[model samples]
Target: MLPDPIHILKTVYGYDAFRGRQAEIVRHVMAGNNAFVLMPTGGGKSLCYQIPALARPGMGLVVSPLIALMADQVAALRQAGVRAAALNSDLPGEERRALWRDIRGGTLDLLYVAPETLLKPDVVDRLATVPLSLIAIDEAHCLSQWGHDFRPSYRQLDALVARFPDTPRMALTATADTPTRAEILAHLNIAESDAFIADFDRPNIRYAIQEKDNPRAQLKRFLMDHEGESGIVYCLSKRRTEETAAWLCAQGYDALAYHGGMDKAAREANQARFQHGEAIIMVATIAFGMGIDKPDVRFVAHIDLPGSIEAYYQETGRAGRDGLPADALMLYGMEDIALRTRFIEESEAPDQRKRMERQKLDSLLGLTETAGCRRQALLSYFGDRCQPCGNCDTCAEPPHLFDGTIAAQKALSCIYRTGERFGQAYVVDVLVGAEDERIASFGHDRLSTYGIGKEHDKRTWRAILRQLIALRLVDVDLSGHGGLSIAEDGRDFLRDKATLMLRVPAAPRPARGKLAHRQASTALPEADRDLFQALREKRMEIARLQNVPPYVIFHDRTLIELAAARPASRADMAAVAGVGEAKLTRYGPAFLAVIAEHGKGLRA
Candidate 1:
């Protein structure tokens, strides 16, 4: 009744093998068993369902969340020679009617519909008449009540399970924590035995977090290695987004601002341009990146701290969807932490909700201040484990670790003697023996704790305070004036029940070399750099002709393979990975010609 999954993958999609749990998920779904999948963005999550869709007997119905994402995915699937169609509100009436005809005629291998569309009674009535081999729900995290992209339409999808009890169902997402994963399974009635949680590691993404210092200058330094590349810069507020975009534009970068407050038409146009153009940077709020299907985004930088690790993972994951090396950088400061703490305490969000939000914020703060592997801490939040990744800033250039036992006690003593009602600045000033008016007026200068920390500079003292806050030794009270109060844990440290080891606030490490991840794409010899650039230019030229993302034509990994292997002809190109019959037939000659001109000593 169907072709083999491996056969469809190679012959249609051009990939030779499945990575990690993809093959296993494909097999399970193909056998009509339900599955809940959690894979990172650009980890080939689509293939797990696409391959089975091709192998199954009837159309594979996909419930996607956004109209843009549905269109983007359908376009890419068609480019790979798969029969795909998207039925959404964006389609013209005639086109919708025609697609319905095709669906009823059973001509489509895959049909992508918005959850809103699928939940319509009439639309459901229409789709039920056709045979569906399997159901795939993309961005399944939205189904959860507490998920970042929660939508109520997903709540009604449970009817699909009741309606088609015999049909296999698969829920998929790139970013979902353990709670979200459990919710997805429970909502879809997918047993835990069928849930496949792939390693939450995006090994292609090099993670780095820096304390905010001269943010504009620091952002420029981070952007230096990534010049002329496609990336995103996230700001916390709409005003910041607009200002940063304008500043980047004035600085001669091709940048645009996107936020909910913008005109609807303008927003849609900007989204299209970013999706289609290369080397364009979008400075946006958290609103811009959900379900973005672009594959060639090289980096995602944040100018402020995100609310949670799940939010951070989902936003930064917009980069490197092609499995090529990418970068994730964030600049956060003590002010940001204090502001977030204040908001959590004062906001009208339910007490339980605020508490949970504060807990999530603490987790992200822990990740930001971690002197060890950021990736390991990040993955651990999702109930995954990984070794120290050498790609992160901490693993790349470890900070100076020093025994801060005395420094901790000094800061704590200052908070204690000053009545624990002063802001961190006042406390730090008291420790550093500052003769400020507040210190003189409050007689803090007369205290014995004053001037005890004269050996360390203000910056060092601030680092100690920040680390103390991160370790929960010092709590920043928002409701009772912004002041430092000793947490229960801080009392232990003050009494010598615990020792303090703090990382010195080191000067900023320069961004890693261009070949940072130095994986498949960047591992080429220095001699091959020019050739790779030429290949990329040629790919762009071809993409302009086809009106698709260059990656949709051929991924950067494919070009790197070509540059390394230096294939001499179409026949030779067939040996390279990602060269299926359809793609090679379409793009092989052009890329081969570029390689022939630039590369010598071709691989036989």
Candidate 2:
């Protein structure tokens, strides 16, 4: 068993050892047992099943959610010299027929198909006649009703358990809380004990949340460090994605816009360019995320707050897939919260689901305002714990805590005095003693609570209100119109004269001018830095010619290792972590030439 998995890992995938629970998972799956894998984005979830498919005697069926994902994975596996192919609508009729023939003939070790395709009875019946090894359901969280990436097609996969009762089955996902995990277990008929939840912390990712003051400027400054790197900028709306992408490009960055609203050709073209080219920034909606397998996305930025912590975690997980240092930044404000709240309120989902969504949103806000470690707070939400990572925004510049009991009382009283039917703007105007027509029309300028908050500017009051909303002391009532109303706790607090503590949002800091700043001297020596860049150039050229992502050729980490070690011969090159026999033979001489030139430089 060790020989099989190790052989597959080193010879096929080019990794010398399994990182986490991957070895255990491969062994369990190969033994023909049911499995439920909850691993991180770059945690090698695919290897758990891919290895078994090779060591096992029958064809492995992978139930994937998207055609693009299937095609991409298939292309990647094929490049590694594996017998893999995807049967999806993207294939022509003849191709599909021929793929089925290959499946029937047992020529393909791995067969990737979408859930809808696999659910067809004829397809199931056809598979029953073939030599079946094991079945894997990728992105299994899509089956959960409460999951952010829910797909009705994944729920239909329950039928596969009954159809392939004798065969081993696996359901894998990267994003699921306790409830969603239970649902996936029940829906997929996997036992509770068989489930594997690997650690959720992507330590290589440094998290930051800015207050969104001058968000465009903040984003521009943030991108200064990550210039000449691949990344994704997530926005709340399609219009924002397009606008941000256009603005970034105009500012001299290569950027692309991707959203569901875009035509297929446009989305595909952008995705391809981002995948194949270096130094590309993709501004996309949540729709552009799930299937992206790029490993060197150095940063991920959110122009707006996401709908849930789950969505935020999943989106940010897209960065630093290769375990290299990366960054995650979000620019959020009170409006982002209010708009996210409105979306949850307007959702046709059941009241219970809406309540859960609101709770999730509040959790995200709590992280933004946390006075402690951001990574610790985020992991705690998922039921994991660790010491302060000292790598996130909060850990860097701790939020200043202020006793806001007086401010809270003032804001809540204003909400109550204003009839709880007005928006925050109106409430703010009344509080700040702005004699506007709306306030005068309502005669609220005469209220006792009016001008009580004049001691604090409108921005200060808004910050207090934002904290109140986050604390559930004030809840946005969306029954008739979007209005600010005191929560049950707000009334209790006022009646009991409770003290409130709030965090002062960090002020926007001036950019360190990282692009102008030299690269960190620690990644490689100054002398080898030039050699590393040459290696990257060669990697990009190979990727473009081969029509694959650059990382597929060699991850940046591997290149860093190559530059540091300057492997002198083919054997030494194979000793590098990512260099397996297939890649070593195909491209070893080319890389060796580059290294030899560096050796010449050193000799000179």
Candidate 3:
């Protein structure tokens, strides 16, 4: 019989117990069964498959999407003494030959391959000769066309099911809505009964959404809370990424830009730098963070809107992967929504797909405009519910609501009276009776709804209009120009004189000076702070020497534990969390020496 999984977990991985459904999924896979896993990012999804792969008889084959992701996982596994390797186009001839030798020699435990490389005829034929333990598809949502990050190559993976009929298979992803989940299950030939769905809440990430008002200023303020920390600032466009990165550098931040538009070498080098260095801010587009494995991202800020909630969740989920306190701050405005809608309407996707995209956009807009707990609204999108989490902006400072019936009527009537041909700026201008030449030339200056909305300022009127659009009381024209028209519901709302409650725009919250920074460092006592820093320096030094990311050797959490516990001997260090046998043997003595020196210094 195979060794006990718990024994493998403690001895090989150094975790005391499995988290959530990890143990159950491992057992199911180990029993030669297929499974689908939907867990949040940083929810120990890797262990669910890694443990089974170790305990099973043959080498496990993992299908990953990105080379960086595969390389990082392989590095971490090797550091833990697992014979893991990856096959990708980036591998040199000698390395590729050696990896195949290991695979044929039955010396590899887990092998991660890209879908494209694995699907090649020669690779498949070669793999067919080897005894396989299990097949795992990470980032499995890419198989679903409905998913935000769909890849056509993922659809071709069904061939694996037919080719490896007896080997157990599992599909895993961190962000998949209901439809995406069903698509993955259907495409992978996994039974519904075998799926494990965990709660889609990341309670550790404090969610904050603000209406875009001087976005650069807002982003800078958010960054103040995360000073000297590693974070990602996502922009909507490649140009914006470069500009933001440059601006951040001007402000004395160690910032770098990464996007598809950059040269390949530069992009890879920037990613490598961000991965290996601490306190570096990476300003990037959506192209940057699909399968990143960094564990200590303290914040994820989006200066522009993401495509959907799944995209938003996946991007923000990158932060605090080590389960520490982190922040997800997003800033959006009317232009962002219009741009997203225009992209959807102009896309070549089928009508059904377009409708689904519109619905997803609507859901995301609702999240942005929600006056309730952001977490509750976010979870509700995934068919999960939670109590009003005190961790979000609304829960911390609830927005004030006002009777928006009159304001809505005036805004909708202005759009209707103007023949619904104008965009938001013209409508707002007409409402506030601006002395603009276009208003007079269009004869909208004399309309009954012209100056009637003067009770609210231009900013307030814009907010009202946005809330109307979010509520489906108004429709944005998809004709490349952002014209506003009253929806059927808006007509009824106007006719029936319905009451509407809209949020009064709240001022941006001030930076919680050193609060976030303190939370990250507070695990160590005042006396242990120096030791923690020293340990971190040592980790960085060793990581640089090996040319690998620091976390591959040990995570910040493990370092914090060492500083607090000050493990005196090899046995004591081995007992610490994240210190498995391989890591203890390789890294324990070095860490213990640091602790010993720190102790001597204290005595002195």
What's the true lDDT of residue 38 in model 2? 94
By lDDT rank, best first, the candidates go 3, 2, 1
Residue pairs in steric clash, candidate 1? none
TM-score leader: 3
Sort by TM-score, top down from the best: 3, 2, 1
Q: Can you give the lDDT of residue 387 in candidate 2?
A: 95
Q: How far in Å is the alpha carbon of 233 misplaced in model 2?
A: 1.0
lDDT of 2 by residue, 236-344 (tens): 9999999999999899999999999999998999988988887899999998878578888889999898878899999999998888878888988777887888888
For all candidates in order, the CA lDDT equals 0.85, 0.86, 0.91
Candidate 1, which segments miss by more than 4 Å at Cα? 346-352, 416-421, 441-443, 479-481, 491-497, 512-521, 596-604
| Candidate 2 global TM-score | 0.95
Which candidate ranks first by lDDT, i.e. highest?
Answer: 3
Q: Candidate 2 lDDT (Cα, whole model)?
A: 0.86
Q: Candidate 3 lDDT, tens digit per residue, 34-145?
A: 9999999999889888988999998999999989889899999999999999999999999999989999999999999999999999999999999999999999999999
* Candidate with the larger TM-score of 1 and 2: 2
Worst 10 residues of 3 by lDDT: 512-521
